[model samples]
Target: MQDPVEIGPYPRKPPVTIVDWAMLVLAIVSVIYLAWITFWHVSDDIHRTIVYVDYGVCAIFAIEFCWRWRREGWGWRFPVRNWYEVLGMIPVTNPAFRGFRLLRIVVVLARLGRAADRAVGDRVTAAVVNKFVNTIVDVIKRPITVAMLDEVADVLQHGRYTTNIANALEENRAELDAMILERIRKDPQAGRLKFVPFHDDIVRIATDTTFRIVFQVLEDPRTDELVSDLVRENLDQIKESVREKDIVRRPGATR
Candidate 1:
């Protein structure tokens, strides 16, 4: 069996190479060719010119694509190769596949620009674009926190549960205030309040009085009992945490 032939080193490198310049000029000329075909006369002369232009652009792009594929180390793989490197050969597919082709152009341009920037010791354009894109995204996301908090507060003020609580408190304000006053009067250690807090503060209201009416369901003896139970539970948790902290700070407390 014959042994495989090995490829030698690249004959030329980058900007100094005529092949690279020719590829770029061919890409530019292809744009002109496309414009001519898109808007020129239909005489045989014009048709022939467009045909030749297409053929020339196709040939140049094919050669450039093949060279890039091999240079990028895709010589060994068979069908499972660098398919993206050879995109320009399919011209008719360009309209439907314009995005894919543009991606290939981006890769080539990025490579060239990166090399040029490295040689000149500057990537100012790339850095500026990156920063600008990041700033735009940050600006778009800046209002998300305020929007979320506003939504939470709105729900708490107008939701069915809160609305029910508000209605119950308003309809039975005298009874509710009597409960608060009785508790404070009976227990000197009870939490102090200048007056029973108004229900409007806890719910949506639209009157000069600013007083809210609790829904009848919440004013029901059963639901009100449950609310009282929950409030006590929460108060117990708070008192426990405070007592634990106070105990820890006592003079002879354990570490």
Candidate 2:
């Protein structure tokens, strides 16, 4: 036999077993029989026997409900959520209220439907949805427009790109100075300069002055505009150089 399907608050075992289904069927039949007796107004001994059967069926349900409640650790929520079941299981002379147990049929059918969907429909639905999305994306996608590319280029060219670079350089100035000093100390040509009494002081002053001059030059708005204009003018030459190199490397290309 297939393994039982567990759902809801049941932790260690399946919430509904074969025995639970049997009890459910019994509860449903008892409700229908009680309804029949009420409609026909039966006053015979058979009515008394049916009444006892009704009590027996309700007892089974009450036991199953409590068993599930404790097993699943549902705490107080069980009574609140399944108040209908609680009412149906209450032993009473009138059969009118017993009809409420019929709702259990709806609950059972819903659970079964959910189980079936989980078993097969979930995978089928996901596959169909994935294919549909892929097809739509492949059909609708297009290359980015020239306007979009121009907007991106403008941001890089005229935005705070250079300002951010200058800020980063300022932040790492100490580290950069140390790296330059290390390089100078390791150089053979700088041996004479290292022997000078104020070598460290001279290097610090020179490095700071050079950094300030470069930073000022780069920070100038006119310098950025000039560089942009130069690149724009030479764009054709850059493209031609790349194409020429590509052609020269081709299998049948002549010198």
What digit string (tens of lDDT, one per residue) describes model 2 on residues 1-255?
999966554221331546644654665566566556645667778777876886786677678778978875879976765544565575543455445333434333333322332334322333443669666444333212233344445555555555777899999999999999999999999856999999999999999999999899879987778767665555545545655765675579997
lDDT of 2 at 182: 91
lDDT of 1 by residue, 117-198 (tens): 3333334335544669667455543344344444444444333554465766668877765665566556655433324375
lDDT of 1 at 194: 26
What clash pairs does model 2 have? none
- The 10-residue segment with the lowest total lDDT in model 2: 139-148
Alpha-carbon runs more than 4 Å astray in model 1: 1-14, 40-42, 75-87, 93-255
Error of 2 at 158 (Å): 2.4
Model 1: per-residue Cα lDDT at residue 168? 65
* Model 2 alpha-carbon drift over 4 Å, by segment: 1-147, 230-255
Count of clashes in candidate 1: 8
lDDT, candidate 2, equals 0.61
Q: Best candidate per TM-score, number?
A: 2
